[model samples]
Target: MRAVEDYANDDDAAPLDMLAALFEARGWPCSVRGHEVSGEVRGSWAKYQVKGIWRADDRVLQILCLPEVRVPDDKLGAAYELLGTINEQLWLGHFDIWSNGGVLLYRNATMLGDDGTLGLSQAQALVEIAVEECDRFYPAFQFVLWGGKSPADALEAAMVDPAGEA
Candidate 1:
């Protein structure tokens, strides 16, 4: 197994980079967008947005995954459910989801609430579900590091591309 530090240092490409490569391999044009969030109420957060344009019909697909912070333990289960829902309804389908503190909710380009929060186990479970479901529906989905790097690391990394520009 590769240590986190080792993988982080490897030139294997950041998560977004890897995603871009995956899309390209599948013959899709992809664009990555990165963002950072910090404030008194939420403290800080990061977001990574990946959008893919299909060459066949010029259709677009997007996936917005982020890391969150200070999530209360009590909310973990609900958060997991939310994550599963996003994977099944939005992410696995045509819509793109982007969020840091909360999982990005989308209604055809309209920003919705970011409602993902859970304990480690629940979070991992949610990730597992995403991995399986995404593979089943969208095999192109890949995970670099799930559960964010120690929560905070996950949040920061999710929102901001290690490559700098989305």
Candidate 2:
């Protein structure tokens, strides 16, 4: 078997380059720096900042979406509990809290495997999934953080889908 580095692209364009292009095409503001591309995505709940980082050595692309929700020190335990509940409901990626900062975010990673190439649609999907998950669960974080709702209750409240338009 060959090493992962053997599959790295010989050109200057990296996986994040694809993300930058996709973000541009979607009209989401973004900046590219080295192997990373950071952008702002608008969700139903709120706007989020997404970062796409490319690792050539592992042939992996990691997407991090911050919902801009900060958990208070007093709500840390409940926040963690909520994270567990939220993550359990997710099938693709997982929700996480930055321990030091108490910031909430959704994270997912895709391995490019031997080819080490990331398609435009794949890049679009990664960002869409991260943003969608964060938006879908943002209210739960709010319920637990400020509304004084338990993790289970908050999840239940936020997970309900509304029927036909009013």
Candidate 3:
């Protein structure tokens, strides 16, 4: 157990350092950006840039994963609908389409307490969810972004079991 005083230190808010150590220990490469950490993860469809941002004021650690698919202006509506449907299927973090840039980001967060450092398992889970979710859905995103597929159709195509049926 950690002392309560540790929480009061501003360094306690530096989640990137902790995450970087964890990544290094696991032999993963990452780029540290101030209070954030970004790394590359290979998914089934593509590799993603996964970034972790720590907000001290909010006591939250946020992980954002970016796939290769970038939504064009004309496809914004389908992308929005795709996100809405896909988000419901996710048990952890969901996708966010930035309005200005039309960038799709996979996001998840964990609230850090003022009493102790975030547990390694908890920190690990946040990173895992970001990667797994992005890998699982990257193809669906591509379908919407470039294939001219409807959200429902894309999601249906994505959810199909490859080994089960055609």
User: Which candidate ranks first by TM-score, i.e. highest?
Assistant: 2
RMSD of each: 18.7, 6.1, 5.4
Poorest lDDT segment (10 consecutive residues) of candidate 1:
35-44
Model 2 C-alpha lDDT per residue in residues 1-166, reported as the tens digit of each score: 2222322333223577677767777789989888888999899989999999888999988999998988889999999998887788889989988987888889998888587777655776888899889888899899988899999999999989999999
Of 2 and 3, which scores higher on TM-score?
A: 2
TM-score between candidate 2 and the true structure = 0.89
Note the residue pairs that clash in candidate 1.
33-166, 34-166, 46-159, 47-159, 64-97, 76-118, 102-114, 148-154, 149-154
Better of 1 and 2 by TM-score: 2
The TM-score values for the models, in the order shown, are 0.22, 0.89, 0.83
Q: Please give the distance, in angstroms, between residue 73's alpha carbon in candidate 2 and its true position after superposition.
A: 1.1
Global local distance difference test of model 1 = 0.31
Give a tens-digit lDDT track for model 1, residues 6-124.
43344342333434444444344445445211111111223222232212122222232222222344444444444453445454333223334433322221111232111223222
The 0-to-1 C-alpha lDDT of every candidate, in the order given, reads: 0.31, 0.83, 0.76
Cα RMSD of predicted structure 3 = 5.4
lDDT against true structure, model 3: 0.76
Candidate 2 residues lying further than 4 Å off, grouped into runs, are: 1-13
